[model samples]
Target: MVTVILTMNLSARFTVQGSGFQSSRREKYGNVFKTHLLGRPLIRVTGAENVRKILMGEHHLVSTEWPRSTRMLLGPNTVANSIGDIHRNKRKVFSKIFSHEALESYLPKIQLVIQDTLRAWSSHPEAINVYQEAQKLTFRMAIRVLLGFSIPEEDLGHLFEVYQQFVENVFSLPVDLPFSGYRRGIQARQTLQKGLEKAIREKLQCTQGKDYSDALDILIESSKEHGKEMTMQELKDGTLELIFAAYATTASASTSLIMQLLKHPAEVMRLFTPISGGYRTVLQTFELDGFQIPKGWSVMYSIRDTHDTAPVFKDVNVFDPDRFGQARSEDKDGRFHYLPFGGGVRTCLGKHLAKLFLKVLAVELASTSRFELATRTFPRITLVPVLHPVDGLSVKFFGLDSNQNKILPETEAMLSATV
Candidate 1:
């Protein structure tokens, strides 16, 4: 009976609502439970130890496997689509782009972009949609810094629009009928590949006898150095994948960070998990919390659910970043208790870059501008396709004086009053 209800709820989430995978069933069904998604049998695991096994079991007990639409849309060349040695080699080449030296070079660029973007936002007299603007900001950074494409502003704007179409339909039905989301996603992918191919060719032609700085150059050089030169199509596919990794989740997290800041002024919010969970396919029948997860069955280890249900946290729902600080160190109770960036071998490759980008954005916003929620009430958050406020997080930005290091006195007082 429990299995039947779980199946129905899963069906509704994917087909009808197309949003939200979280449910209160964790309390009733325990951490490990069986369900189905898109006709594939799945075991949803939530507890820290349970998730630890799933993540650490990568390539041994399970392997990465996204949805059919996702695999088709992202193509087979991406790191997420590959397995075994192929995935490892790809990760090694990709690692160079996010190495400590590369990130140091990217710091100034990230800060400058955020400063300029927030400055422009402050100049606007009316409320601005933070989620929309954050996407544009992250997209520009990904193109200019990560891919090293110095295209014109108009062209960048057009590319961002097309990319949005691709992301919007990444989780769509596999049907390829006219005007279907999957059809539109395929079209958008083709358009993006064309643009990326042109850029790759230009870079390859002009980059001889020069040191590689940006991620694309590094990827090209690293691939050749590793004795596996990527084809034009592979480079193009990989570029799109990198942009997808850097742009969407970062934007979602940035918007959520801003919302948290506005709501809980002085306190830092650590639970900005835009991605609810990750998918893996069980390689063999494994006993997890007394349930036998059969071979070939898909497994989804829940990040949000684990954080919410971890026994270490005092008030799991409350916004308490300090629990992670030196005094309490709640997350230290277990290895997988807190996973904003995930863990194990398949941990996020761009984790450092994402954190640096958010840190810079936070510093720039706090130092340069005073912002307030434009809406009377905090907007409801939606957790499909990535977490984001349903209302786009409208806010008013005001530039501070050159010497001003913080918000105005009254604004600080108002924030304190709310706290």
Candidate 2:
């Protein structure tokens, strides 16, 4: 294994040229190659200490740069590309949309989405592919919450097909070779941009009201307040950027969460038990697993890694959510690990919403049915900007009795239900 000790001014790049560029390469390198792209120079980083320093550092030493492909796909003014005061201002505006009050108000809508998805899946064949289904659920939710539009079912399917192509090739070489995945992705982005521009124009003409509850509405309101409205092109780019960033990773994490729970039945039962403390217990399990990312490197934290490492918990590789019941800061080193949403200033802004969606989805699934993974071995995995099970996770769902169902309520249920 290629474990690099944390140090200052340390930088190394691992290319995907060798056969080792697959999963094993990522596992061996750990956090050291987080920022090293296929062809770019290796960015130097130590551990959490260095990650904090670089993110908080002055622009000259650790500036956020948008790769050409990302800029072309998401546009220059998107939040991912904004910097300094501009970035901070945009975050402030976006933050209001993610407030607990706002998210609470959307609970009914979220439940409706989750219920409808489960109902649809409940009727499927014994071995239904969950990866595809999860993506559909997330994409639909994005449309409802972010775009304030209800896409037709057929159109939504087509959109996912096209979006997948675009997402898969966004990091590929920019050349527009005919029939190439990169070329197809560029085309899909253009199509999405055109659609978003039309939506922005319509949103601009509407009379603002509480009923107009979507991120686009908030963005429009904020832009007007700042006297700096986005142009049609800017709106299109920014909208697509937000949708792309928010939907994929969160959905994948949720899928992984379910898989882990089902594979480890004992853990699932412990997690759902009254004594387990439900969501709090689950959160601790997520944290105890090591995500030892080094500074300067932009590595993804594999929840699987944390779940697999035995030293972190008794029978660490086993799926025992009860292990989480005993987990305390004192048990592990002082570090609070396990990063589903990453850390630092660039951490996901939609984290609150993502967690809410995942919790709701998990509750709905766990309550309504019992599911089993059909495959003996794990399916082939792929990383197209985000991780996805290439073979699609096949699962069988059996109906559950209401008495057997456990619906864990949020701490602020009284105030939120009233709101």
Candidate 3:
């Protein structure tokens, strides 16, 4: 099983290798069953009832777990790695920094970065790789708004290359030797951390008398609080986690959101394309809907599977966005069934920020710009860690008069209601 899974994932034609196992397995296994993946004894649980249990039962019944490559590359001190009380504290600090208030404060910075990026794109007047460009744009936001770095133009290209390699290879083999994803991720993480350490130090020294507002300032303030302070290494590890959270997943979500909006004219739609679900290591033996799941097991509640399964979503393969309308409310089939941002205490802290990022990007694209796909046919969906259109959807961009089809409020409200 490990050989089969690894062969499929590590092959030369890796980019278009999105897993279709969930669709077939849900048909055969009825949304909850044991399976082997990544050379481990694993349980793949789907459906709303089952998903609710895993996410809502976090910590007491299950604890956070990630692949070896992910754990090693991200380090142990990150909020993603901590559990129980420690996880709560780390997340609290993060929540305060990422709150709606903080988002509004950072809005000006975000607006400045995006406006400049769009203007630069306009000047090109040629086809561009939307996926790659999305990643670059999101990374710029992370650097300026989260870490407060100037990042010279000469250095930006190298910085992007390092972070790109880390994200691209984060799911590969965990071997730390040369030519391994784990090694490259480790090296890149170190390079990023060293630069962050300097930034944090300077932020602390310079912001002593003035009011501080950036994400870096929030973190530095938390680190100085008596009895609740974070250590330097913890600060650095947390920064790496922040960059990963802000840049990679948001970039992917932002890219996918635009594609969905562009295709909104079509009759069918998939509400969410989950990047990946997480593993929850069992903390004690328990029965899930009469099935015994032993302690030490690595289990994940499958988000994609639940989204595709028939019981929760009618005509699961069709692109009917209104399935989530107040009249239908298909996602309400199970209180725990629809998990776009996950569930329970461990739900993604950055979800609000990511959502806002995509919302603004969608509005900007739909309102001020007219774009045409350079490729006539739609590209295949591929999961290179995250989903991407196979060709990155090369497209030509041109400005539109701000008054055209400006996405009426009622229609926009209906679109928002769908997902």
Q: Estimate each model's TM-score.
A: 0.90, 0.74, 0.86
List candidate 2 segments past 4 Å from native.
1-36, 44-46, 58-60, 202-212, 265-336, 401-419
lDDT, candidate 1, residue 349? 95
- What are the per-model C-alpha RMSD values against the true structure? 6.7, 9.2, 6.8
Q: Write candidate 3's Cα lDDT for 319-352 as tens digits.
A: 7867878999887767666677777988889888
lDDT of 2 at 56: 42
Model 2: per-residue lDDT, tens digit, 60-102?
3344654456556666777777877888888887776777877
TM-score ranking from best candidate downward: 1, 3, 2
lDDT of 1 by residue, 1-419 (tens): 12322443374564333323445566667778777765567778888999999998998899999989899999999998999999999999999989999998777767767776787788777999999999999998898778867566788899999999999989887889999999999999999998888877877777544333888888988999999888998999889999999998999989988888897643332465888789999898888887778788888998888877789999877877777779998978888988878888888999999989989988888888899999899887777688888888999988786434332334312211211
Clashes of 3: 3
- The best candidate in terms of lDDT: 1
lDDT (CA) for every model shown? 0.81, 0.56, 0.71
Better of 1 and 3 by TM-score: 1
User: How do these models rank on lDDT, best leading?
Assistant: 1, 3, 2
Q: TM-score for model 2? A: 0.74
